[model samples]
Target: MTFRLTFCSLIALAAASPALAEPVFNRIASFATLDNMAGDEDRTRATSAEIMTATPDGKRLIYSDSPLGAIGLIDIADPRAPKPLGNIAMDGEPTTTVVLGDTAFVGVNTSESYAKPSGVLRSVDLAGGQVVANCDLGGQPDSVALSPKGDMIAVAIENERDEEVNDGAIPQLPAGFVLRLPVKDGQVDCAGKQVIELTGLAGIAPDDPEPEYVDFNAQGDLVVTMQENNHIVVIGADGAVASHFSAGSVDLDGIDTDKDGKLDFTGSLKAVPREPDTVAWLDNDHFATANEGDWQGGSRGFTIWNRDGSVVHESGPAFEHALVRIGHYPEGRSGKKGAEPEAVKYAEFDGARLLFVGSERGSAIGVYDVADPSAPVLRQILPSGIGPEGLVAIPGRNLFASANETDLGEDGGARAHVMIYERAEGTPAYPTIASQDLLGWGALSGLTLDPADSSVLFAVSDSAYKNQPAIYRIQAGSPATITDKIVISKDGKPAETIDLEGIAADGKGGFWLASEGNPEKEIPHQILHVDGKGAVQQQVALPEDLTAGSTRFGLEGIAMAGDGMLWMAVQREWKDDPKGQTKLLSFDPATGEWSGVRYPLESGEGWVGLSELAIHDERLYLIERDNLIGPAAKLKQVTSVALQGLKPAPLGGALPLVEKRVERDLIPDLQQWNGYVQDKVEGMAIAPDGTVWTVTDNDGVDDASGETFLWSFTLGTQTAAK
Candidate 1:
């Protein structure tokens, strides 16, 4: 089930990294959810890791996989390289899982209808991977928690309402409550079950107090989040309600409120309800909630609260702003809950008390040092796989784990994944290039090193921000930052029909941009010359002979050759070219003539094509990568075609094949990020001082973690300090 391919498992490195921060958590390994169902089953089906818990020694992990109707397990004996222990079949959908000693207690939902919901508590032996006991519950369960003493289990019996009926308005019958079961000798004592009533407490939907999530503190006190009702409740050890209150609202400012193709965070949401999704006991007297709103509102942040329902600290828009600064903001979800913080976990790491908040939509987790609960400090933000639904920390081993619940298997996209991270003395190994919103940006597609200053670079965003296509000026510093941005303009307005994928600097204080064409989308395959002021000076259309043979996978990168002629790299084979070959087009600015040569491409599993082109030392350096992601990504390299004897033939004539030499296998550099290999290695450049810089596009935060990795290598040249 764990296929280890030497070629794909190779880890490439760019620079030697010591600790960037004294105590930081860095990714160690990633396991795909489909690996658990790799036998005779249809592994292509959707799978998920909704909730998870690790063993006492951190040697194994048990998680709920609802889509597969099973409890999945992973052997973390070697934490850095986790191996799948396979999934144990469950009679019903497992909602949440909790580990106690040698057994895993799971809440299983067997509901056939909303009105008559039913569930069961199943205990599975971790050693034998078999269900040892099952206890029937009168209602459905959503979350499961274990007592601090490991003597009792708490289950949030959420008889949830159907979203399809009347927009999922609450008070729709069959109210829910909390179920506490005693544990005797590592086995759940079903005979000692207690159903604690939790209805007629919420002001909005008092008749249906649907308990969504439950977490227990050391004093046998439990905090429950009634998500739909926007309420919170605390239950004491005697199975009696202690105190309850509204989760409350927040007035958020400087937030994006629309999906209008912009990263503008100037809008505001006033009096928004903090519909809490996941709750964690910050301490015996305090707790935290991720405000993932339902129908009413979502504060787009997190909040810390006292047991008596007093707000201690409110994140408001600060967390989402951190995501925006890292280019992980979900612009498409602006109209909804930005980032949608859904999971919260509290633990002590080393000598620091920490809180981990997971963003379901942004695919990011914000780590906070909660030593001072009233004023928590944002320590780090870890990139998670799509839809991080669950988080578990293994402090004993200094390891952290995330259960990412998104499975795009039906679309042949990335399956659900579980990522592991270790606390160590080293840099984060991600975001070599990041921003503090010096200028809001995303989807960086092309890079152009400053012809004069080796430390200055310029990059461009693609059609993702079609309404305002802009080129960013980057300061190649330790954490290469975006210092400024220039919006490309047409007349007096932002260019409309543009998909700027490549950029090249002209000698006359201007730039030549190659916009990949999508004719059906009204965008033409053309090149534009822009003055230093960012105004369009001239536009050149492809010759009819070449235009007729082009596809949407048009010109990807452009560079200036030795003769002052502009050269562009076609991403893929066109209608006229043979298989596994694309064109290196040349356009003479002085003569207004066009010629082309064939660039041979190596065959791979997925389509392999050029993404970027840079002219360094008279050779055409190009970034070539496959369209696949993760382990399926077999090719991501920088290859150069010597220009010494290269000649371009006229359009419609037989083109010459240019031989290439592999300059760098970029997979190593990409692997240093420690997550999955990004599919786009789109931008590459060589500084005047010989530093090799490259960037991967974030796809404008669409179905992505929106992590744009920018790093430099001094492979063949001396590393220079900027």
Candidate 2:
């Protein structure tokens, strides 16, 4: 039930609260109802136009109503006293936002002009209380991201919908484009000193890069999440196609795994399959991805693979609930409720010891111990919120952070906040929701944990249209202490692009990132490699081709290989162009060299949803969201056909079907829950015991009784010729 409290009651509670009180109740009981500015009078009602972000110190919360054109800052430094800091008026509605130092980069646009877009990159100086730079963008900008040191800015530009509204459907809308500008001191060079255009990204829908999900690595590499082609575009500062990864364009609703009831998290109850946006790494050789299952009742999940382009495991709908729980019915006699199969949306390994799974609809985070890969066991569960988009593990303090994209309601009110959990340093690990920070602007989009220093973190939001997507450098104050934030933004500009989706720190003092450029023009996605000081060292552009234009599968997910090379995941394109095929590639950090291109999946390949990817011990794990109708939902494994091709089984030495059946009979019950039979699997992690831990998206199969589950598996005994 939704609860509302008065301002006086909140103050009284805070005054009487203890310094170290832990919030044990569900979210609804903890967070207060934000002041509604839409003037709708329904104060408790929430919408999707709000933005949220964590502080650079991982403390305090910031939020803004992009549609309402107002910013709300809350001093979450004290979880008990989450009071508002202040509010600021925006020029227009903010489509996306980014924060750096004391400045916030905001994208201003009008809601009425769906297509006749006009905006500029405005720099909001938090300390100065004025816009430092409001440079005209020529075209409407969608997403934005700052370099590690805040030297470069990227924005996604799109076509003017109203300008060419009658121009024969605007030629299916020109491809999305990205603009790269250099930021120095407190000034920005927006006069097109360095501009890169990406054309031919098919399947990208209108307002394609909606939830500004863009990122940049230490070396200034860029990765932009595009919903149109459902892929992440990767480009360098020099305007080159470093590589590409595909996330088959699809949504995460209407999928069924067990055919129970209550559409599994957006009708993911049915299973058929899917595609990409977010990405993470298991190790140097492996990375992870977050995909949209399918548009028409398909599976939604993640994927994993090796640096050499080999599929290791694919899992989806890991948990299937058959038991029913009774809920009070007003009239009594309404009969029973079926089981629901919840799907897993995001997954990642915490410093190689624990596996974390985020469920989009489940609104929770599932944890697994990967000490023994083949026997990963559920260790604990934590309640999260809408679009639990990003996860990061802080090593030194044994802390974990989950980025909540929306408020308690997915409807998108401006109540988004960042939640932090920490495990006791002593014995049997116990995790408590330690603290939370309110981001008054931009929804929490993505997060990246620092391998070298857990105290340092990077987080961003995912909306490019209504502005307010930003990145924050957080310094941990204490296990329960609020964080100190340093917003990352362009030179002195308040308005920029939309989202910052991907973020990776270069071990050698730098970072790599990708951002949604211009959505109006068919521009190539941008990637940059920057030094620790936040200086762009090199730049790359998405491959220019018909598929690149239509698919927008520019480089989406990215990771650093054990061999010191950068790996990228590309999405598939709908156009009949050779570049539309999804593949994995590698790039050199020092020489700006990109190579090792391998197409693991063919055009219109195996499944529809191939969202997230992870690589482990030379094995690639892909999250294949199978989208199908009726019951019987499943996930699939795309074992590297390249590896399968390596060992041809000596042509005539193939085992007979009868013999195969006999061998299968010798094995234990493979259909049992948690059983691994090479079905549809998405997220995976390698355990210390040389086994693999995996999770699946059930998509609420049996009567809305669907669930997310964890699984374990071992490598085959027979050593295949490698």
Candidate 3:
């Protein structure tokens, strides 16, 4: 550990005893090089999700591809030398992954058609140093959990089919079911396995639509979470419904499970299904979920529950009248209006429920009380300066993690870090100041706490800006510190940090990161790997297809799916040409290769800009920055796609689909009164229970919008427009 001891600390420690090992937060190299501008194809843009991860043995590093497809990979055997291996294709846009031995299960989805294999659940093989196989699934698989033996993979699947219209409008179906795929030997063939229908179990009408998330209990029983119904359905191995519990049911103060003299369940767990989100398993009988209501509701942060269907802890406030009372009214004498409350999700830490919750408007984390499963309560808040978009946590060490972006003066900036909390009682819940800042030390665009040890932290910075961002490490110790940054340079001079945004740890010895440069500048985009000592070991430039463009091909969000492969999401470059949609790409960590296929969103699909990118279990969770719409940000999940085999249909379409009403009413208000438009959504993280924890970059609300507010989205709930 390279220690950057504070001048005073160095003297005291040295004078008293041998100086403790400290990690120095030094600069390495910057990424620069414009690509595809000189009439050359292969240009790329930037997104906020550029993070990396290492293999279990620390021999290779994996990174995501924010290109047309949703995945990418890298090899990092040498600290100062990184290389790109190969890439692959997926059914839907790829998000996150979970690695076992040689297999990686990826989450994907398509619009309104998740019942079939629209959600591509790919099983990648990394044993041969290359991706050998990829598979697709019927439902939009959100998260993945492998049984102890790595067989019978439980994937939370959701089919967002359209609900029926009263007149001759487009038809929509209720939410679909979650599937448990059995990975036998080295292959994944869903047709040969048993598929359980979850619609009926959750009381979901065949026409009321909702998404499904699944996780295994301590005994390996499947716990399926439905955002619409606000319930968890336990599926036994026999494929029969074991039990069903309400996410909205809370153990009231009058009814105590422990027979204590206090209120048992304060606020119930409500279903705030906004978009593709997450849920987490707290323990064998306990679980935590994000309570951001559906398109018609509002919630902030997560809630804990016990197996007997009781709320143990409650954070934030409860939803009344099926809606989170967003007090937007102003007092008669005051000039300011009320601010909106937020929600939480994407939690981790087994012993303690450490969740990363952010507000749709405010850039902060809502630290809720989860000590009890029947009565969780909101306790403190961690304001991450700008938007707290993503979250990661490591238990047994009191370490909480998050990622966000801020302005470095005129130089727009981003940061990712691991904050060590003082778990002692009365410790002032959320520290006004961060335990340690990984700013210049590293990029806070993406970060992850080492599952192996919370003391070890990894972070990645987006280099798409002029300063080529890099990766850095931080170790927990007295006067806890950061290490020197590590990034590869071209032609001896470090490139301007384009956007080294995403990061992840392999839980072994090494770390990985992804970088995206300005395509208009014609610079090459690639993924890099680094050793614990902050050395650039390997690097891989993106593929031609991913970079072929003179427009800005923004490659950002990234993560490691299972199988040592990498997944990425990129914003389509907008230039002189007409507006079109972007795509998700994949890469191979073993050979620094690229997959030719890309998963394109629906035509006319538009995003204000993509920010925080995350993956958990087997699903992908990405945050679309404030898109001039209702609420301040947009959270989306890419679950299923229409893929026939290795081939797909044509590409080249309009921006992401935008409803006419959304454009006029929902989108514009995000900028309310803050002279400048709000770029609300920024960072994002996934909890073990499948909840999506995201932060906002409200840049301060406009006068018309009243006070500034942080926001969080529960999967099925609808939120108020900014």
TM-score of each: 0.94, 0.43, 0.43
Q: TM-score ranking from best to worst?
A: 1, 2, 3
The worst-scoring run of ten residues by lDDT in candidate 1 lies at 1-10
* Better lDDT candidate (2, 3): 3
Model 1 lDDT tens row, 1-722: 01111111111111235633457777888888888876898876888987988998899988899988998999999987789889998899999988887888889999999988999998888889899989998889999999989999999999999888888887878999999999888888888989888888999999898899999999999999998889999999888899999998999888889888867788988899999999999889999999999878889989999999999999888888777766788888999898899999999987889999999988888888898899887767788888899999999899999999987767546678898989887656654666635256889999997787778888989988888788888888656767677899989888778899999888677899999997567678989999887789899998888988778999899999767989999999998999999999999988999998999998998799999998988889999888888778889988998888788999988999999988788887777766777889899878766678899998887677677889888646432211
Summarize candidate 3's per-residue lDDT along 585-617 as a digit string, tens digits: 556788765652343343322354445455665
- Give the Å shift of residue 182 in candidate 1: 1.8
In model 3, what lDDT does residue 267 have? 27
- Give the Å shift of residue 204 in candidate 3: 5.9
Per-residue lDDT value at 692 in model 1: 87
Q: Write the residue-wise lDDT of candidate 2 on 74-192 in tens digits.
A: 45445433454555667776655666667777766643466456667777877765777787765666556666667888776643344334542333343446677788775667775
Candidate 3 global CA lDDT score: 0.43
Q: What is the clash count for each candidate, in the order shown? A: 4, 260, 230
